[model samples]
Structures are given as C-alpha cells and as structure tokens.
Target: MNLKNNIETILGRPLTSDELNNINQFKNQFSIDEDDPLIVVLALVGANKILIEEMPKLLQQKANETIDLHRQTLITQSALIAKDLIHVVASSIDSSKSPIQRATPYLISFFLGGLSLAIALVLVR
Candidate 1:
C-alpha cells in the first residue's frame, strides 16, 4: 500500500502539504523507496500514536460507566433490604402496641435506606 494513502486512510483525511513534505524528506534521508516495507511500519507507528493519545479518554469513559452501574446496584440493594426490614418489623410488632410504637420501625427503615443511597452517591462521585 502507498504510505501516504495508508496514513491518510488511518487518519480519515488527506495529509497536508507540509506533512507530505516531511514524509518525503524522511524517506530521502533514510534512502527509503516509496514501496519499501518500512513504509507500512511508519504508517502503523502513526496510527499507534493516535490510538495512544485517545486511550486515556476511552478508559475513563468505561470507568465512569462501571461506577454508575455499581451505584445503581447499591441503591437497588439498599432499597430492597430496607423494604424487607420494614416487613419484618411490621410483622413482629404486637397488636397491643401504641400507634407511635408501631410507626417507629418504618421511619427508621426509611432513614437507613436514604442514608445508604446517599453514601452510594457520594462514593460514585
């Protein structure tokens, strides 16, 4: 493949005149022909540089996605656990208990669930 064409294909655009001149100068300096196998290596090195420059952003995006997923999971788990606790508390309450006593467990469960969700949100950030 033509080195200039290959590099342009990889970059998704045609090279500038200055870029073409630089390639030509390098080839002349190294006594390298246009069809030399080293042209392929040069094109690949250029592609590698582009990929390396983009790598950190790609990794950070994936990391953010993973963190969001974990946060959602934590919130779901907290809500479920709180619901189950409320059910257990309600079932265990005595029928003879006062109205305030019967409502206390539910209030506590809701508070704990909210606290857990807040913690998960903070951790994700």
Candidate 2:
C-alpha cells in the first residue's frame, strides 16, 4: 500500500536502462525531456484524482497520507508546466528564431490561470 510506489507503477511505460540503473543505484533522476514527461506526469495525476473520488474508503484512516499524495501530485504537475514554459520563453526571446516571442509570456500566464481554475473546480467537487 505504498502510494508513491503505486503512483510510479501506474505511469505505464518503463524508464530507460540508464534510468533504471540510476534508480537502482540511488542516483537522482532529473527530468530528461519537457513535453512527454509533463504529459505523462499530469495524466497520471489526473487519473489519481479520479481514483480518490471513486474509492473514498481508500483514504478513511489515512487522511494525512491522502493529503500528502494529493499535494505531491499537485506540486509535480505545477513544476512540469513551469518546465514546459521555460523552453517556449527561452526560444521565443530570440526574435529571429521566433516572431511570437513577446506572446509566449502571455500564453503561459493564461495557461497557468486556466490550470488554477481547473484545479479549483476539481478540488471543490
């Protein structure tokens, strides 16, 4: 009943050989890519939200564990979105590389605001 391990398991695809070795060797697993990891992490997070609602008894006595799980998922998801925006903002600032450079910040702000609203709705329900 280790929730963190269960969350890691339900993420579906396996990590790379080096990643597995690093994990086994107690090495820190830094993020390798941007979009895919964010998508996968967020998707897993969304699925977890569904599970919490559907299986209420899974959280009865373990209230603190449930809260911790939710908090960790939220923090990971937020960090992923931040990482995604970093690439856009970095490349967009080069006028020659991206004509829409100035718009990226606005896009990121809008996305973050929307995500916040979505999270509020999810939690309130």
lDDT of 2 by residue, 1-125 (tens): 32234345774544446544533333224443333344455445644654566476756648977777887777667666666665655555645545466677657766775676567547634
lDDT of each: 0.77, 0.55
Best by TM-score: 1
Task: Quote the positional error of residue 115 for candidate 2 in Å.
Answer: 14
Worst 10 residues of 2 by lDDT: 26-35
lDDT (Cα, tens digit) per residue for candidate 1, span 37-121 = 9988888776566568769999999999998888888778767876776677668877797989978877776777667667766
Query: Which candidate's lDDT is highest?
Result: 1
List candidate 2 stretches off by more than 4 Å.
1-60, 95-125
lDDT of 1 at 2: 82
Per-model TM against the reference: 0.63, 0.30
Task: Give per-model CA RMSD.
Answer: 4.0, 23.8
**Residue 85 of candidate 1: its Cα lDDT?**
65
Clashes of 2: 0
